[model samples]
Target chain A: MILKTNNLCKQYQHKDGLVDALNHVSFEVNEGDFVTITGASGSGKTTLLLSLAGLIHATSGEIRIKDFDVVNASDRKLSDFRRKHIGFVMQSFALIPYLTAIENVMLPLAISKFKKEQKYQKALALLKLVDLENRKNHLPSELSAGQQQRVAIARALVNSPTLILADEPTGNLDPSLSTDILNLLKKINKEEKITILMVTHSPLAAEFGNRKINLHNGCIN
Target chain B: MNIRKLVWLEFKQHKSQLISGLLAITLGIAVIVGIRSISVVSEKAVAVNLDNLGANILVLPQASNVDNYYAADIDAPTMPEEYVDRIVSSNLEGVDNLSPKLTRRVKVGTENVVLTGILPKNEITSKPMWQQSGLLGNDLKASCAPSNAVNQSNGYEDEKLQRKVIDSLGADECLLGSTISRKLKLVDGSSVIILGETFKVSRVLNETGTVDDDRIFIHLHKAQELLKIPNQVSAIEIMGCCNAISDGLLSKLRNVLPDTRITTIGQIVATQIQTNKMMNKVSLIFLIIIIFVGGISIGNFMWANINERRKEIGMLRMIGFNKATIYQMILAKAFVLGIIGGIIGYILGTAAGVWLGPELAGLPVQPIPSLILISLCISIGVSLLGSILPAYLAGRIDPFKNMQEV
Candidate 1:
């Protein structure tokens, strides 16, 4: 398995009471599985994906990635794991505004143990893959929403992670642009055999995945 | 990520913020540097003055019931010759030179002048580096009287000039101070009439930037004879170890010669100390205000930088930068800024300070080490001090909250 969560749980507390975002949610993403997790708003798909990505702590139960027990790992180890093995594609496309497209793509590589020249070469290649090589010098603000998303995708793939977790990756795009992004994700999955776990509310978005799991009231079905 | 690259990225991302931190560091360093330079200048002034003054104790005759110290310039009173013998016999530590000086008030072309007596050999002990400006002391040495106190003195000792009778033992010539020479336009061979006697201006001492710079100097024997005093010397100006003359020695001197008086150089230098203290107070207040203003500018700039970098910090943390890395990044930016500012401020401050020294002293200003040291210290200090707040705020960034904002 590339990522596995056993009996995972997450809670959201309010002044009146507690809300279960994820309740005893158990799931797995095997290597090369392009899994799409679909749910309505507040159905806990985002929460579950966050927990699996190690962005947040699970209230209870275990999350393991590639034979490493992430739940038992230290903060340092988790950070290193995130930097090396996990890439996140946020709904808003978290491209640093100040950095050029290529530089933004090179960030993770910059943080890694890769040599400077190697990182540049890898980032350049990834930018080319996203068709943003010509627009590599453009700032995030200078790029269109679709181009920004492409830069973000290049950034996610620059470190060559085994698992990619994206939340609403194409939710902000038009149907045509959404299709392009979905096709790009599919191409990456087919060529690199990387596991992709995506959470989305759109059934149309879910259709691009190889398998779909529905989340309702914090339970997987 | 390697710390070096991370730090560089952080600096690059937050150039303005880093500049803010740098400004703070640079300013703090500049203040320290500027203060240090002034203190150094004062110290140099002290050295120059001490050199020209030569004798530590300056014995101006006691005025009759005069309370104002600054206005108490009186006629030269004859000191008992016996006290000189006692001071010489008392072998004290650090007692390198003792020479008597007599001040006579004279009018030269409508300008009030003061003529002082000098022993040419005393320059070596007092103004040890006096000959740096190529002023000859040949005639002064030549006209000196051998007081049965030492062996053959060096330099041209002419018998003709020594035989010019004032009260029977006066030297033929006088030396003009640099300022006095400039004021009277007297050259090396110019003749001047003073005290109804014509004396040749044998030499002019270089501008030493002391009271000596303003006076006329003559051989001791010439001063006594021209002033019509015989066998009577002015106050015994002692320049050697002050500690050697104690209460016991003073009492012994009184016992040996009851009519003679004894005073330390400390009493003579009290006015100078007061002036130094006053000037220090004024400079300190002004410099402190300037530094505080600069520090506030830095602090305000750093605070703004911290606020501006909040999102960047959040993003970095989200990307897996730990607390230590964030702190280190901020501090590194601060340090780089400080170093740059320090270098710039130091260069600017030193140039200005040296340029202004001559104007302030009314003479040529030389490069002083303490000034340079002060500037360097200020630059470094400002750099470090400026970083504290920005680094703290950067450290306080909560990645989740910050990243979620935009």
Candidate 2:
């Protein structure tokens, strides 16, 4: 198994009362598995992904990713683990607007001890994998929506992370572009044997995954 | 691909937003440097002037007009030269050294020059032990004497003319003033006739920017003989000890020479010192105000920058950059701004100081090299101090919260 969560719980303080964003959720994924989490808005789909990534603290949980304890680890250890083992793709294609496509792909390796030439080569290769080699020098603002999303995907894979956590990767694209991005993710998952845990509201995107998990009111059904 | 490159790209992209802050720091530093430079040069000029006025006390004949200390000997009525012997015998306090002058206007090659007779140090020392020991002894070496007090006491560019009061002058040799030399077209060793007597020019005195520059200095006995004034001098210059001057030296000298007009240059020096002190205080106050205003401007600029880059910061955090790195990136931008501002401010400030020093402080100003480092340090210090809080807040930004925002 590459990922596991035992009775994960996340709560929020609201003016009305305490709200449960995640309630006793538990799941596991084997290596190279493509798991898609589906839920309506406010169903804790994003919260669960954030909790697993250690971006937010969970009320109570046991999340183990390849023997690294996500919930109990210190901030430094969690950051290092994320840098070395995980790649995150956001819905809005969180690319730094000032950086070019190749530079955006190179962002995760900024803190690495890699030489400048080595880093550039690695980022160029990732951009080529995502079919953006010719457009590597184009800034994010100059790129189309699909091209921007492809650049974000290239950034996510630059570190050769073991797991890719994509939150609504195709949410901002057209139906045709969305299909292209989903097919690219599927290709990366099968060819590189990298585990993918993605959250989506679209049934079409959820179909691409081999394992599907649906959530309603913070609980898995 | 590195933190440094990242900082460069980010700063270049958003530099437009920082223009106001950069300008504020630059202007503040420029004002401070300008004021300080003028103050420094003005004080130096004042000190040089005080040094040029070597003697503090001037004892002129009662019938002479004493409008200016430098020209007090010009057109002066004669007084009995026995007054020098009288003062020496009285053994008054603060009597360091005396240079009894007998000035007369004489024609030298169609040019009217003031021929002033000055008693040389050796001449004074040649007197009887009872008179010379009391005048040129330990008191002449005291800190109050201008020649012994400052390295540039005479403000002379020529090394040989550094001492305004020379030890001796040959009876047939004379020292020409800079103006007299240039006007008469004479050089050292040139012979000039003054009142039908030929005298060799031993040396030309450097320009003092005073009446002394238009005079000729020869032995007192020679001047007295040429002018036919025996036992009479125009004025007696007394180097009163600074400590005794405060202890009623002027009143004591007045009591001894009841028929002579006694004056001291202390009043003029005091007024100039007061003006310099006021300039120093004004500059200090301006520095404080600029720091306060400039610091706020920088802090506001950094805070706004942090707020605008919330999503970008969040993205970096998601990519595994730690809080410390985030904090460092913000401060790095501020540091760069400070360096740029400091250099430009220093250049502008120096120019302004040199240009306006004469108008404001009535003295020529020169750039002080040490101020370059001082300005840079102050600029960097203010930049860092203003950005610390904003940088801390930037480090605390939550990736999840910021990324979730539209």
Candidate 3:
């Protein structure tokens, strides 16, 4: 297993009263599994993905990535764990605008233990895997939305993360482009044997995963 | 790997903001350094004047061959040397320096030079010029220094060289004034035939831009022996009397040495310190205002950088960047901007200082490395101080919230 969660919960103190974003979620993902989380806009699929990624604090419960408890770790330690173990792909392709495509991929490796040349070589191979070798030097603005998403995906895998938490990876793309991205993720999952946890609201997006779960009223079904 | 690239990307993307911040520091530092340099240089000029030049009062034997208006001046009947001790014992707090001298015109190699014999005791000739002359003894050392007294004396002495020079001069060595030195083409450690004997040229006084420049200075005992007057001084020069106190000292000297003719040189000293203090007050006020504005510029720019890059920061956090690295990156940018501004300010400030010192403050201060370093620290310090709040905000940014904001 690459990730495990037990009764994990997250709450927000809104003016409307305490609202549960993640309510007693329990789940596990085996190595190399592609798990797609589906729900309505505010049904807590994104919140669960965030909790699993250690991007936000969970109100209560256990989140273990390969048996390392994340909830109790210090903020610094959590960042380290996230940097070394998890990768995130966002909806709008949050690639730094000033960096080129390959440089975007190298961002995760900036503080890595790899030497400079090794980091470069690793990033190069990932760019090739994402089929962006020719476009490596292009800025995000110069690339199409599809190409930018590819760069974003390559960035996510730069650290060879144990779990890739993608929040709406294809939401900004057309159906064909979305299908292409899903197929690439599936290909990466099978070939690299990496676990994938993705959140989305689209039924078509849900079909790309081997296992699908839905969230309603902050509870999993 | 590629940490510099990340920093460069951020700076490159926000060049205009960085430049404006840099301008603020530059302007602040430029004015501060320019005015400061003026004050520093002017103070040095004052010190040099106090160190090397005339006393306020001259006490001469009354009506003694009266400062020869036409031909070579003859030595007057000596003022009682006991009068030196009398004025000293009177506990006059205003007296800064006092030296007795026997003055006469002498023929040195066919050139008539005003030879003033001054007691080169450490206390008598001592008004600490920048350089220590072996002939002037410790009187040429820095005055009224602080605990960094050692620092004040550093490079001012070469004891061995001075000792060798002083050792050769007891009654035989003589110091050449700039005019005499140039006229005679004399160099230090050269043999000069004076008073029918070979005297070693010990050191030369710098050009004084006054009548002293045309004079040759020899030991008091040497001049007395040349004049066949044993144990008598022609006059006493009293230091520390500005125009403010010249009248009172003249009366006191006339009473103490009843047969002496007292005169005041009226060395006003220009009150350079007061003038410099006023200039300094103005500079400080301007500096504070400029620095505050520069600091705010840096702070505002940094905060905006954080705000604009929320998603980028969040992305970085997701990829394993920690709070410390985030803070460091932001602060490092500010620091680099500060350093750049400091360097530019230092160059421009030094130029302004050199140009304006003599014109406005009438003080010539050479730019030294220490002053340059101080200016660098000030500009950079202002930039860094401005980054604290922005760095805090950068560090505290929540990755998930950052993603949501975008």
- List per-prediction Cα lDDT, in the order shown: 0.64, 0.84, 0.74
Question: What is the per-residue lDDT of model 1 for residues A1-221, given as tens digits with 9 covering 90 to 100?
Answer: 77788898888888989888889888777899999999878888877776775667778888989988877776667767877887777667877776788888887765567887888889899988989889988999999899998888888887789888888888778989999998999899999888898888888889989989898999887
Fraction of native contacts under 8 Å reproduced by each candidate: 0.18, 0.54, 0.68
TM-score on alpha carbons, each prediction: 0.65, 0.71, 0.70
> For all candidates listed, what's the TM-score of chain B alone?
0.51, 0.54, 0.52
Judge candidate 1 at residue A6 and give its lDDT. Answer: 87
The alpha-carbon lDDT assigned to residue A42 of candidate 3 equals: 87
User: lDDT per residue, candidate 1, B122-186, as tens digits?
Assistant: 34233433233112222222111112122133321322122111122126677777788888989
Which ten-residue region of model 3 chain B has the weakest summed lDDT?
Answer: B142-151
Evaluated with lDDT, which candidate comes out highest? 2
Q: Which stretches of candidate 2 lie over 4 Å from their true place?
A: B55-119, B122-279, B402-406
DockQ score of each predicted structure, in the order shown? 0.18, 0.35, 0.38
Can you tell me the CAPRI class of model 1? incorrect
Stretches off by above 4 angstroms in model 1 are B1-39, B57-263, B267-300, B351-377, B401-406
Please state the error at residue A197 of candidate 1 in Å.
Answer: 1.8
Better of 1 and 3 by TM-score: 3
TM-score of 3: 0.70
Ordering by lDDT = 2, 3, 1
Put the candidates in DockQ order, highest first. 3, 2, 1
Worst 10 residues of 2 chain B by lDDT: B142-151
Per-residue alpha-carbon lDDT of model 3 for B1-406, expressed as tens digits? 4666688788888888777768877877877888777766555545444432445456777866544321112466676666776676565544545667777877888898887776655434343331122223444332322112222333424421132123234577788778888998898888888778678888886665556666767787787887777778877766543422422656766677788776654334445346556767878797788668988988988888889888778778777899888888887887788888888888888888888877887555456557667777877788888888898888877788534621
Best-fitting candidate, measured by DockQ? 3
